[model samples]
Target: MQIVDRLMTPSPDDADARRCPHDGTTLVSRISPLRSAVRRCPACLRSWSDVTTSATADPPARFHSFRLDVRPEPAAPSAAPPAPELSVVLPALNEAAALPLLISDIETALAGESYELVLVDDGSDDATWAVIRAVLAERPQWQAVRLSRRFGHQAALLAGLAAARGRAIISMDADGQHPTEQLPEMVRRWREGARVVQAVRASDARGGMLKALTSRGFYRAFSRLCEAPMRSGAADFRLLDRTVVETVLQASRTTPFLRGLIPWLGYETHHLTYEPRSRIAGRTKYSLRRMARLATDGMVSFSVAPLRLATLVGAAVGALALADLIYIVAVALWDGRAVPGWASTVGLVALLGAVQLFSIGLLGEYVGRTYLALLNRPPYVVAERIGDSSGPPPAGERRA
Candidate 1:
């Protein structure tokens, strides 16, 4: 832990005899263009810059170099703690005011169970990461991960799931709308051998009539198009067995749509319906734009029905045009004349053009997804990881 603080500007007479201040060992010097000369201790690997000998000059001039602040050696990594039976993952963003109560509720609900709480800060501009750090200081069993930036709610949840070291994992929101009281029941269902324990939102009193209608319509369309038994009002608040977690991580290497993907797995599942509570503090993070993005991810990732729909529409349009041509020919043949209208021709052309453009745009969406996948970008980047638990292994080791 010693630091070499003294200056070492060696002259031509004793250029090779400089010794390390910390260990009294000989220093190795490497000449460089910008740095003039770089000195490093072979034994300890500590580095220093020597600006006295410029490579471009025949007779190097002497100059003082700034000292770098000394840094302590990293502590040795300790053995990982025992794996918990259950891991609760919560992804938070700008919910600093709601965390303390949420943590307390989780603790009380899982009082007797061996569980660990993993809080993920999804690039919150607020003090969300600061609060997470305080929690980690007091609770050794807890874990916190801060992403490089906000990768959306699903990516944050996936990051937590990647770092969870439990036989079963439960994921929920940190905005306090998801009730922790239902946790025990979800655990009970897991104990009864259910691989997936879904917490379906029976009712959202906070959501107005328009939102309810849109939600219902989306689910119905999703179920019909994707052909998966995705329950209407099913939410991200759910418990997953270890196998399901691993499978999801492997399958969803790109963007993940958990609400749709989970049901598509067709695993043995147990559904529990509960009414959603209002946010404990602050406003809803999911704006209309984000909601639309999520809906697009769900539909695009799990189903190709949009492309099929385009084909079906094209076929229907072509059939109608063919019938109209037959009728026109029949009228002209029987009556020897036909009425012409500019407004009718213009309307038909415009309608057909709109349908063609819509079909092309739909095809482009699918192509864009493929292009992104081929690029193989990671879903999220972890800027910092803090915990006593060693979570999961690296992707390479896991594959091995």
Candidate 2:
């Protein structure tokens, strides 16, 4: 096995002669308008982009992998290139440090497969967008989209999905928590007729025992509350078939929690579990408040069980009050103990008042959601787009 490299710019023969490092198929070559070398493997569909200086005596590539050594026998090229087989969509926020290594991990994971990396910057205040541009210069298969402001995690994922043109789409985070090593199995499962391939976390050590229990509780509650039972530990790191993507786009959910919606969409779903990696970069963007809001969104948008629970509580309280009234009247007639006890009366009033406030607050949650949905506000707005929009819809058209 040997390492090899190709020139940034090549002669017609040199261009046609390039092959995929993962597999020994002579690559189909084309030059992009940006003067970048775009090469594709006809057999495995793995793609490459070269945009270094265009000198004839260009230096050989320093980057090489043991798994991606040059092939002994170069396979013949096909007549036409096929569409990308996979789209790795990552939603990023203030992830400047993690972007470089994560992208490399993605390439390594899908070395022989025809895939594109779609990175959606969810209004990062850091140099994340700048890093994306730099990386794009190095790899033509990379596509970056910048959102106007922080649209939260789910919206960013939606934006990337909307911009991805690949037949199979995989959504993950940029925080390195979602392992790229599992990508191969996901693609394999997708090809094997699984419309939705969900990645489940074996365990999370980031937040210790209490946080873990809380997360587990949320999933259990969500499963019971909603019609669709989301698999425990199911996460955003999952693959979606093209049809599944279309199905998701059809529903205008203002606060869509895809872990639930994907299952509810009624496709053949498969699950894979892997231990989540610890973050190597900045602190998590999800604060306590954000997590609570996200939890609320998942519950309220997907289930009516909360509203039902409130109603049941109201009825039960009413029944208890009626029984208490009957008991008091009987005591007054039989034992002449009808005098009101100040302490008990005060306690009863306080308890009843608390319940009333709780019920009102619960009702307000549903009402607010309904009112927002009726207003038809867009879940996200795109401030600036990073990549070319030749295939996927533009951000402007992706409103709501």
Candidate 3:
């Protein structure tokens, strides 16, 4: 029997420096080998010989053959079908008036391909659900899910995406601010192998100066904090490939900022600029308080900037306290002045009050989140599901 030694190459591309099984020494070739194939290590000299033809021969002579074929067969092609046409998910709260126009625009956007429109009603006190049902009745292409109570805008959007059947999904505002005309461009980007296609609203002709300025500032601050490739003027109106959608969905947390989450999930993304149109109907759902809360969520979810800021503040306070102690010591030793009782009392009170407030605020932020989690409160609840209840209920509907 012939003995053969095998060596493992460092890389598929590298042919030299193969490990020798006999002496455990690396074998280096003067010239590059034809292919980096697994061969017998020279050190151990361990080998296997063919004895089929020499079965009757006793103590057959050993022959070394290094020309044996070790190539592997090529893999078979994938049998999976092409991705679905498009899935449009709209999150609406008290947007009954704008639903018709939004639906119409979506239908126009998906003219060439088979598409499904999912409307998530975020527990609107108005006739939003009624309007959604009416639209579905008139347009069979549309489907909807109603939350038991208001689950906030982001949660509703998540619900819609979870229920989407299309291989590519588009998320837009129910306020009709997002331009449906941009759909063709977004779809083109998707076809060109972009996993995430963002609709960046470069101009908001309908918004006032104050709103525009605030938005620009927020985006700027957010971009700086996030590591993802975030650009200014990007909005939630965007399209995602099936893989990206699945990836984002898998990262399901109670506080979901999809716009930020898209970048966190590494994928090829494309951005298209468009002018945000005016709302077709209904007042804006996002009040100042809600916007602040959303901003806080986005900041905390994507970055530790706040925590760092808190650290800086604590350090600054410590330094100030040290300075105050030094000042009091100087007055006692050198100034030969009596320590003013009111001044010390006032300074201590203010300093302690500021510290207490800051600490409470920081603790409240973390405590509030923990409370929500402990309660096991769902992000949203589905009161009724239209079209295919056999399938999974809308996002945030499943009880943990």
Candidate 4:
């Protein structure tokens, strides 16, 4: 669909030639200033812009009072332009049932602008690919990337974001839990010049007591531990402008904590509150084990607090050991009796061993991440391409 039909209003400079962010192509103006202006990108899709500023320049006073319209000239017609609206990237794993509704909600939210939907299916052994194909068939603006295997949700999201062509990109869950209705507010904030719009979960009651509590606790601790500015209840359902997306893409790390990565990139940001909804269909992709692993990953990926704590612990243990040694020597020299309990020695030995092991494990986690980085493995490999067949299909597109 053409983008102008979706605009609630138009901008005053709507008739002026605008450059596409994805490609340096100039766009042709389709409508007048009163209505929405359709600027078809030379490389991608048509986009609509609101008419806030006037296309006609103010008349010069004094001698010019006699009046001339002094209206700006319209842009020349050009090749198909790149899409100008936001790119919505939804990472899916066995989420066939929820995909349709999620897409519908996003379409409704982005009613007035042109957008591209990139659905990255992360190795689902179900009808997820079928659903994606169906959506793309119905909507030419959509794209699908299927991975060869389950590269995990974060990797899938990264793939989709990498392929996004919008000036702004948004990432959210495919389970319909992330409310698409909040998108307009995000876009409004973007229009107000915020580069990043983070969605902070107002409440996660649908996630159940255990999961919700764990999530809250993790975020609370993480905020205190990480140097990066991460909100306590913020999540992956976020909108990023072109600058933020480009910066993030340049961060070439195989193991990525995207929620933390954006803040580290340092951009003007805004926050929106949305109650996270329960999954409409399919089981929860993030199991407890997966959550724990992700938490650990976030901790190590974003903070050095663990390492510092380890050093402090070691120092404290050494001081205690020295004090104990001094106490033993004083007892032998003055009291003439060694205050020794076999049980106490055994407990102390076990405690020290456990502490040593725990410290080693924490250090090893960081080392393991470093090792993975050194290996330089591709985050995900695409197995097939379904609709366009231009390159290898996404990984999950492969037939079993």
Candidate number achieving the greatest TM-score relative to the actual structure: 1
lDDT of 2 by residue, 8-113 (tens): 4343355444666765434335543325566544446577654444555443343221133354555667644445878899899999999888988988998999
How big is the RMSD of model 1? 13.9
- TM-scores for the candidates: 0.75, 0.73, 0.71, 0.72
Give the top-scoring candidate (lDDT).
1
- Superposition error at 250 for model 1 (Å): 0.7
- Each model's lDDT comes to 0.82, 0.78, 0.73, 0.76
Cα lDDT of model 4 by residue, 68-105, tens digit: 11334567688555665778989999998898888888
TM-score ranking from best to worst?
Answer: 1, 2, 4, 3
Q: Give the per-residue lDDT of model 3 (tens digit) for 282-356.
A: 778777788778878887777767667777887788778778767876787787685567556666678767976
How many clashes show up in model 1? Answer: 0
| Better structure of 2 and 4 per TM-score | 2
lDDT tens string, model 1, 235-339? 899999999999999998797999999899999999999888878899999887888888888898888998899989988887776677667667777985677
Output the lDDT of residue 65, model 1. Answer: 34
lDDT of 4: 0.76
**Of the pair 1 and 3, which is ahead by TM-score?**
1
